[model samples]
Target: MGCTDSKDNLTPEELAIMNGELSLMYQAYQASDVDLVYRKYSNDGIININQWQNVSSKLKLAAYSAPMPPKIQKFYDSLKAENKYKLRDLLVIGIYLSTGKSIDKARLLFEAYDENDAKVLSKGDIQQMTSFIVEVAVEKTCVLIQDDDPNNVQPEEMAKFLQKLRTVKNKGKQELCKMFLGGNPALTELTMEKFVENVTMPSTVQLLTFQGVRKFIKKQEVTASKFAALTSLKKPTGPSDPKAELPKAK
Candidate 1:
């Protein structure tokens, strides 16, 4: 005889109760009421609550599955092999800043000195990077809110989020530094690769594959070159050339 399935052995009444409990648990999850959800399910019972928890977590990930913009995708495609690590760091920094998370703690990931004795990104450097991220986020958010359909994000909601973002930005670099660094000053410094491993979230890491850091670097380079070219152009300090006189002075 074939082995019997335990689920098949449940009586009609038992099956009905199990289904009802599941339904109630799902409702609680949708409402984000963890206490109610746990009350309806037994963690130490035969119901396999861990499986249901995993399903709920996956559903939450689905909401942030918005695709990156085409421009960002192209930038990511253009990055050289060596710059991949930099791109990863950029993504982590972007995610933290966008989520209003602290970066001071992340600074512990940098080394005090490289092989050449040059220092890596200091706390001040991190603060500057955060400011740059906040500016870029503000610009992107502004464009997103102007769209007829901004990836299912409502205009009012986006406006409110932006307000919160600006509030964080206005806290100034020192406050931002303190928030991330905390009271502890002693922490082991890791390389960029190690740092990426610690900070990259599996569910959201794909969002950064669009070359966010590369795009920012490219934009800065273009702006700098344009400024240099404009500065190099010498303005005329004398009157118009005689050869180009205006119609014999009319």
Candidate 2:
């Protein structure tokens, strides 16, 4: 409800943030937009055992097993061992997993921002959630590159960049979470005017373009041998260029 607040008085920058067009924004910020099956499940805080079971089942079955966040794993283990818990707990667990935070951290966050006894997940939760996701993203990128080839320059460069980014504190993370919360409907006791006021400052927005993804790999980081190998692969050239082709009819 808060996310769709009237845009009549908002500035262009704020509008763009809420419109979900920011370059560096994470897909996780728009989790509900990409046809996730669990998006329909409501997070109201009424204690309901059946609802918790349903939510947990859906989350577990949604994808093939992979390493889950610690909190999520713990939540599942506890649920399996003893099927007694509050739906509120499960809702917080959902946010915890989605935002990539440990259960302890997420629980502490819930205590601070839970609008109504864990009934509502407020906008305050998005900041750390996004920060952790971004931190993890940078770390994962470095790890994957290092695993593939320890000598790769990209990973070293990326690690250095990540460290540099960290030096600025959580400024980037805060901006990202601002955009995330502004775009998402996870707010309580927060005013659109207040959000617009804070987000109006264009200087704070951080775009994680990473050479717009394509150039980051192909042009900037790809080894000559790898580039050559990629170029050598058979691929569709699409329709012939009309100007390069012989005149159809002489």
Candidate 3:
């Protein structure tokens, strides 16, 4: 009970590195990159973390539980303050594992790690969440375009609409135009699977059209951004689109 903290041994270098401001320290812990992880902490031949609980007891539990690289403790610690729920369950054990004790313990911890509901989270969690959102957005766009009507417009025009939809800055405006002009056929042609393969799910995908579609892109520019006059626009699907009906007399 006198002084049993494991982290108490702060080598001079560890104090200097109190972080080089590189999240790499965190990654090193994850990769088990001893060199980099060594840069961030000191082991004073004993654990003496000055925190919510006793350092030795903390390491013992972490050595037996927790998931993710032990260094993520920093991120989790920050999250604990705000998203107490997100880290409460994971960090209690994660706090222990981040110490770089033993992978065997990590594996065991993972097995029983679901001890609590996924704890809440913190602003720090946004980094990973942002990446995931981008992926989802890209995929959603692709699926929305599949099943082109094939008529009432050509595949060429359909494709142009998609290009603009992505390039445009505002989602609300893009939605308005698409609704007013009816569905863009090119988009209907792009399937969810194809979209995911060709574009970043959550990112901007540059859509290029053949010469004909390029013509459409320009035409839209000239039409004061409104749908072209009925007389100026040609049949929707060119000679394709099996389901498209014929144009009636003026």
Q: Which structure among the candidates has the greatest lDDT?
A: 2
Per-prediction TM-score: 0.28, 0.30, 0.19
- Summarize candidate 2's per-residue lDDT along 38-72 as a digit string, tens digits: 33454443334455445445544321235443433
- Residue 183 local lDDT, model 2: 49
Compared with the true structure, the alpha-carbon lDDT of candidate 1 equals 0.35
Which window of ten consecutive residues has the lowest lDDT sum in model 3?
203-212
lDDT of 3 by residue, 1-250 (tens): 0111133553222222222212222222332332222222323312223332232232332222345334434433433433232322332223222334333222222222222324322222322322222222222222222232222344566455545533432332343223212234234232223322332221112111011112233334555445446466776655576546566669
**How does each model score on lDDT?**
0.35, 0.38, 0.29
Every candidate's CA RMSD: 20.0, 19.4, 21.8
Best candidate, TM-score-wise?
2
Off by over 4 Å in 3: 1-78, 81-109, 116-236, 241-250
Clash pairs, candidate 2, are 24-208
List clash counts for every candidate, in order.
Answer: 0, 1, 29
Error in Å for residue 230 of model 1: 49
| Ranked candidates (lDDT, high to low) | 2, 1, 3
